[model samples]
Target: MHSVDHRFVELLPTPLERGVLYISGAHDIVAHLCLCGCGNEVVTPLGPAGWVLRYDGRVSLSPSIGNGALPCKSHYVIQGSRVHWLSKMTEDQHHRAQARDRDAVRGLNPTRLGRAKRLFTSLLRRGRV
Candidate 1:
Protein backbone atom coordinates (compact mmCIF):
# COMPACT_ATOMS: atom_id res chain seq x y z
CA MET A 1 0.00 0.00 0.00
CA HIS A 2 1.23 3.52 -0.78
CA SER A 3 1.12 6.50 1.57
CA VAL A 4 0.75 10.21 0.99
CA ASP A 5 1.57 13.27 3.01
CA HIS A 6 -1.38 15.63 3.29
CA ARG A 7 -1.15 19.41 3.33
CA PHE A 8 -3.88 22.00 3.65
CA VAL A 9 -3.10 24.88 1.32
CA GLU A 10 -4.83 27.96 0.02
CA LEU A 11 -3.46 27.26 -3.42
CA LEU A 12 -1.55 24.35 -4.98
CA PRO A 13 2.21 24.68 -5.30
CA THR A 14 3.86 25.45 -8.64
CA PRO A 15 5.14 21.91 -9.05
CA LEU A 16 3.30 19.28 -7.07
CA GLU A 17 5.64 16.95 -5.25
CA ARG A 18 5.23 13.21 -5.51
CA GLY A 19 3.74 11.35 -2.53
CA VAL A 20 1.93 14.46 -1.35
CA LEU A 21 -1.78 15.37 -1.37
CA TYR A 22 -2.42 19.10 -1.54
CA ILE A 23 -5.92 20.04 -0.38
CA SER A 24 -7.35 23.52 -0.82
CA GLY A 25 -10.54 24.23 1.06
CA ALA A 26 -10.54 27.76 -0.30
CA HIS A 27 -10.66 26.39 -3.83
CA ASP A 28 -12.64 23.23 -3.00
CA ILE A 29 -10.15 20.97 -4.71
CA VAL A 30 -7.40 18.46 -4.03
CA ALA A 31 -4.33 17.90 -6.18
CA HIS A 32 -1.69 15.24 -6.17
CA LEU A 33 0.57 13.28 -8.44
CA CYS A 34 -0.51 9.88 -9.70
CA LEU A 35 0.15 7.28 -7.02
CA CYS A 36 1.37 4.81 -9.65
CA GLY A 37 4.46 6.98 -10.25
CA CYS A 38 3.12 7.97 -13.63
CA GLY A 39 4.07 11.63 -12.96
CA ASN A 40 0.59 12.78 -13.97
CA GLU A 41 -1.28 15.40 -11.98
CA VAL A 42 -4.59 14.12 -10.64
CA VAL A 43 -7.07 16.64 -9.31
CA THR A 44 -10.26 15.84 -7.42
CA PRO A 45 -12.81 18.55 -7.02
CA LEU A 46 -14.74 18.74 -3.75
CA GLY A 47 -18.50 19.09 -3.90
CA PRO A 48 -21.83 17.32 -3.44
CA ALA A 49 -21.38 15.45 -6.72
CA GLY A 50 -17.62 15.06 -6.39
CA TRP A 51 -15.16 13.63 -3.91
CA VAL A 52 -15.55 14.47 -0.23
CA LEU A 53 -12.53 15.12 1.96
CA ARG A 54 -12.37 14.29 5.65
CA TYR A 55 -9.63 14.78 8.17
CA ASP A 56 -9.00 13.51 11.67
CA GLY A 57 -5.23 13.71 11.90
CA ARG A 58 -5.08 11.68 8.70
CA VAL A 59 -6.79 12.69 5.45
CA SER A 60 -9.46 10.68 3.70
CA LEU A 61 -11.35 11.02 0.44
CA SER A 62 -14.70 9.40 -0.31
CA PRO A 63 -15.23 7.60 -3.61
CA SER A 64 -12.28 6.14 -5.49
CA ILE A 65 -10.37 8.07 -8.08
CA GLY A 66 -10.37 6.39 -11.46
CA ASN A 67 -8.00 7.72 -14.07
CA GLY A 68 -9.33 5.76 -17.00
CA ALA A 69 -8.51 8.53 -19.44
CA LEU A 70 -4.87 8.60 -18.37
CA PRO A 71 -2.41 6.24 -19.95
CA CYS A 72 -1.85 4.32 -16.74
CA LYS A 73 -5.57 4.02 -16.03
CA SER A 74 -4.90 3.98 -12.32
CA HIS A 75 -7.73 3.38 -9.85
CA TYR A 76 -7.49 3.78 -6.09
CA VAL A 77 -9.08 4.99 -2.91
CA ILE A 78 -7.54 7.23 -0.29
CA GLN A 79 -8.33 6.62 3.33
CA GLY A 80 -6.34 7.79 6.34
CA SER A 81 -3.57 8.86 3.95
CA ARG A 82 -3.18 5.30 2.70
CA VAL A 83 -3.69 4.34 -0.92
CA HIS A 84 -5.72 1.21 -1.66
CA TRP A 85 -5.36 0.19 -5.26
CA LEU A 86 -8.27 -1.25 -7.25
CA SER A 87 -8.36 -3.46 -10.30
CA LYS A 88 -8.39 -1.80 -13.71
CA MET A 89 -11.91 -1.43 -15.10
CA THR A 90 -12.88 -2.75 -18.51
CA GLU A 91 -14.08 -0.44 -21.32
CA ASP A 92 -17.72 -1.38 -20.72
CA GLN A 93 -17.35 -0.86 -17.01
CA HIS A 94 -15.80 2.54 -17.61
CA HIS A 95 -18.73 3.63 -19.76
CA ARG A 96 -21.24 2.51 -17.15
CA ALA A 97 -19.31 4.28 -14.40
CA GLN A 98 -19.29 7.48 -16.43
CA ALA A 99 -23.05 7.26 -16.89
CA ARG A 100 -23.61 6.72 -13.17
CA ASP A 101 -21.45 9.75 -12.39
CA ARG A 102 -23.43 11.90 -14.80
CA ASP A 103 -26.71 10.87 -13.21
CA ALA A 104 -25.35 11.52 -9.74
CA VAL A 105 -24.25 15.02 -10.70
CA ARG A 106 -27.56 15.74 -12.31
CA GLY A 107 -29.39 14.76 -9.14
CA LEU A 108 -27.51 17.27 -7.02
CA ASN A 109 -29.57 20.29 -7.97
CA PRO A 110 -30.11 22.49 -4.92
CA THR A 111 -33.65 23.60 -5.60
CA ARG A 112 -36.67 21.31 -5.40
CA LEU A 113 -37.97 22.56 -8.74
CA GLY A 114 -34.67 21.82 -10.42
CA ARG A 115 -34.58 18.34 -8.96
CA ALA A 116 -38.15 17.63 -10.02
CA LYS A 117 -37.37 18.76 -13.54
CA ARG A 118 -34.36 16.49 -13.70
CA LEU A 119 -36.36 13.56 -12.32
CA PHE A 120 -39.03 14.07 -14.95
CA THR A 121 -36.46 14.37 -17.70
CA SER A 122 -34.73 11.20 -16.55
CA LEU A 123 -38.01 9.30 -16.42
CA LEU A 124 -38.85 10.46 -19.93
CA ARG A 125 -35.48 9.36 -21.24
CA ARG A 126 -35.90 5.95 -19.63
CA GLY A 127 -39.49 5.65 -20.98
CA ARG A 128 -40.61 4.74 -17.48
CA VAL A 129 -43.32 7.39 -17.05
Candidate 2:
Protein backbone atom coordinates (compact mmCIF):
# COMPACT_ATOMS: atom_id res chain seq x y z
CA MET A 1 0.00 0.00 0.00
CA HIS A 2 2.90 2.39 -0.58
CA SER A 3 0.88 4.34 -3.09
CA VAL A 4 -2.20 4.53 -0.93
CA ASP A 5 -3.80 7.89 -0.22
CA HIS A 6 -1.43 10.14 1.68
CA ARG A 7 -3.95 10.81 4.41
CA PHE A 8 -3.95 7.12 5.24
CA VAL A 9 -0.21 6.61 4.74
CA GLU A 10 0.90 9.77 6.51
CA LEU A 11 1.37 8.71 10.12
CA LEU A 12 2.52 5.22 9.28
CA PRO A 13 5.87 6.40 7.89
CA THR A 14 6.80 8.89 10.61
CA PRO A 15 6.68 7.04 13.91
CA LEU A 16 8.91 4.22 12.83
CA GLU A 17 12.18 6.07 12.96
CA ARG A 18 14.04 2.80 13.20
CA GLY A 19 13.28 -0.48 11.48
CA VAL A 20 14.78 -3.55 9.85
CA LEU A 21 13.58 -4.92 6.51
CA TYR A 22 14.56 -8.47 5.78
CA ILE A 23 14.70 -9.21 2.06
CA SER A 24 11.94 -11.70 2.28
CA GLY A 25 12.60 -13.81 5.22
CA ALA A 26 9.85 -14.99 2.83
CA HIS A 27 10.09 -15.65 -0.91
CA ASP A 28 10.59 -12.14 -2.31
CA ILE A 29 13.36 -9.61 -2.02
CA VAL A 30 12.51 -6.42 -0.12
CA ALA A 31 14.06 -3.00 -0.59
CA HIS A 32 14.39 -1.19 2.75
CA LEU A 33 15.71 1.94 4.43
CA CYS A 34 15.45 4.05 7.57
CA LEU A 35 13.69 7.35 8.22
CA CYS A 36 15.10 10.32 6.32
CA GLY A 37 15.50 11.90 9.83
CA CYS A 38 13.67 14.98 8.61
CA GLY A 39 10.00 14.51 9.18
CA ASN A 40 9.16 18.00 7.98
CA GLU A 41 11.17 17.30 4.86
CA VAL A 42 9.08 14.23 4.21
CA VAL A 43 6.28 14.99 1.79
CA THR A 44 4.62 11.77 2.83
CA PRO A 45 2.11 13.74 4.91
CA LEU A 46 1.02 15.83 1.96
CA GLY A 47 2.40 13.61 -0.80
CA PRO A 48 0.23 12.77 -3.73
CA ALA A 49 -2.78 10.79 -2.63
CA GLY A 50 -4.86 8.41 -4.74
CA TRP A 51 -3.66 8.20 -8.35
CA VAL A 52 -1.97 11.54 -8.18
CA LEU A 53 1.11 10.30 -6.31
CA ARG A 54 1.96 7.90 -9.07
CA TYR A 55 5.26 9.65 -9.52
CA ASP A 56 6.81 9.88 -6.08
CA GLY A 57 5.59 6.51 -4.99
CA ARG A 58 6.79 5.74 -1.46
CA VAL A 59 7.63 2.12 -2.15
CA SER A 60 8.31 -0.40 -4.95
CA LEU A 61 5.54 -2.88 -5.53
CA SER A 62 4.50 -4.26 -8.90
CA PRO A 63 0.72 -3.91 -8.91
CA SER A 64 0.41 -7.10 -10.90
CA ILE A 65 2.09 -9.45 -8.42
CA GLY A 66 1.38 -7.69 -5.10
CA ASN A 67 4.95 -7.92 -3.77
CA GLY A 68 5.23 -4.85 -1.59
CA ALA A 69 8.84 -3.70 -1.64
CA LEU A 70 10.37 -2.08 1.41
CA PRO A 71 10.99 1.64 1.91
CA CYS A 72 14.04 2.30 -0.30
CA LYS A 73 12.40 4.02 -3.23
CA SER A 74 15.46 5.94 -4.38
CA HIS A 75 17.80 5.02 -7.23
CA TYR A 76 19.07 1.50 -7.00
CA VAL A 77 22.72 0.70 -6.38
CA ILE A 78 24.04 -1.28 -9.32
CA GLN A 79 25.71 -3.95 -7.34
CA GLY A 80 27.44 -6.58 -9.50
CA SER A 81 25.53 -5.58 -12.57
CA ARG A 82 26.39 -5.38 -16.25
CA VAL A 83 26.36 -2.34 -18.51
CA HIS A 84 23.01 -3.43 -19.88
CA TRP A 85 21.35 -3.94 -16.49
CA LEU A 86 21.70 -3.04 -12.86
CA SER A 87 21.59 -6.54 -11.51
CA LYS A 88 20.93 -10.20 -12.21
CA MET A 89 17.22 -9.93 -11.48
CA THR A 90 16.19 -10.70 -15.03
CA GLU A 91 14.41 -13.86 -14.02
CA ASP A 92 10.96 -14.22 -15.55
CA GLN A 93 8.88 -13.94 -12.38
CA HIS A 94 10.93 -10.98 -11.21
CA HIS A 95 10.92 -9.16 -14.55
CA ARG A 96 7.85 -7.01 -14.01
CA ALA A 97 8.64 -6.47 -10.36
CA GLN A 98 12.11 -5.11 -11.12
CA ALA A 99 10.69 -2.88 -13.80
CA ARG A 100 8.13 -1.56 -11.38
CA ASP A 101 10.84 -0.98 -8.81
CA ARG A 102 13.02 0.94 -11.26
CA ASP A 103 10.08 2.84 -12.69
CA ALA A 104 8.87 3.90 -9.30
CA VAL A 105 12.41 4.99 -8.44
CA ARG A 106 12.88 6.92 -11.67
CA GLY A 107 9.64 8.76 -11.07
CA LEU A 108 10.74 9.64 -7.56
CA ASN A 109 14.07 10.88 -8.88
CA PRO A 110 13.88 13.78 -11.25
CA THR A 111 17.00 14.43 -13.32
CA ARG A 112 17.55 17.82 -11.78
CA LEU A 113 17.28 16.53 -8.23
CA GLY A 114 19.59 13.62 -8.90
CA ARG A 115 22.16 15.86 -10.56
CA ALA A 116 22.11 18.16 -7.57
CA LYS A 117 22.70 15.32 -5.16
CA ARG A 118 25.39 13.90 -7.37
CA LEU A 119 27.12 17.24 -7.56
CA PHE A 120 26.99 17.54 -3.82
CA THR A 121 28.52 14.10 -3.46
CA SER A 122 31.20 14.84 -5.99
CA LEU A 123 32.09 18.04 -4.16
CA LEU A 124 32.16 16.23 -0.88
CA ARG A 125 34.41 13.55 -2.29
CA ARG A 126 36.77 16.23 -3.56
CA GLY A 127 36.68 17.96 -0.16
CA ARG A 128 35.71 21.12 -1.95
CA VAL A 129 34.14 23.94 -0.03
RMSD of each predicted structure: 9.0, 14.6
Q: What are the clashing pairs of model 2?
A: none
In candidate 2, where is summed lDDT lowest over 10 consecutive residues?
Answer: 42-51
In terms of lDDT, the best-performing candidate is 1
lDDT of 2 by residue, 1-129 (tens): 121211222112323232222222121132223232222111111111101112232332222222123233222221211111122323453556567545554665476346545544653564431
- Cα lDDT of model 2 overall? 0.29
Q: Determine the C-alpha RMSD for candidate 2 after optimal superposition of all C-alphas.
A: 14.6
Candidate 1 residues 1-129, lDDT tens each? 388899899977868899999988876678898899998888776776668999999999988888787778888999999999998756776787789767777777567336445644753564423
Worst 10 residues of 1 by lDDT: 120-129
Total clashing pairs in model 1: 0
